[model samples]
Target: MESVRTCVGCRARAPRAALVRVVAIDSQVVLDERGSMPGRGAWVHRTHECVDAAIRRRAFGRALRVSGSLDTQTLQNHFQRNG
Candidate 1:
């Protein structure tokens, strides 16, 4: 069976491997490609909209329980870097 995780933004459950694992680091969000980061985790779909929504809604901060906003450009940069 596929492992499942809940998206902190929409609170939707999906296959864990289908989600991108985001972690808060030094108040910035980093995409955990290996899914082995040791910190609070937030999950979002790999789609552009989902990622944009998550950043716009500060879903990572909500999931990581942080108190600041993360720039959406970072997520875009990540996708460019990873894609």
Candidate 2:
């Protein structure tokens, strides 16, 4: 069985291995491409829609429990990178 994680954007629980891990560093959202980051982590579906939702709703901030800015540039970069 796969581990399960909840998306801060869609708030849907899914297999951990099926989700993407995101971490917050200095109040900026960082994609944990390896899922081994050493800080609080948030999970989101590995889809553009999910990633956009998290950014649109500021769910990353809520999930990471930090109050600060989000680097949309990096998020867009990730989306573009995945394309």
Task: Name the top TM-score candidate.
Answer: 2
Give candidate 2 misplaced runs (Cα > 4 Å). none
lDDT tens digits, residues 1-83, model 1? 88999876566899998788988787778878898999888888877667767767767777788886764567768776666
Residue 5, model 1: Cα distance from true site in angstroms:
0.9
Model number with the top lDDT:
2
Query: Candidate 2, after superposition: displacement of residue 42 in Å?
Result: 0.3
Backbone clash total for model 2 is 0
Q: Compared to the true structure, candidate 2 yields what TM-score?
A: 0.87
For residues 34-59, write the lDDT of model 2, one tens digit per residue: 99999889998888888888889988
lDDT of each: 0.78, 0.83
Lowest lDDT 10-residue stretch of candidate 2 = 69-78
- lDDT against true structure, model 2: 0.83
Could you estimate the TM-score for every candidate? 0.81, 0.87
Off by over 4 Å in 1: 80-83
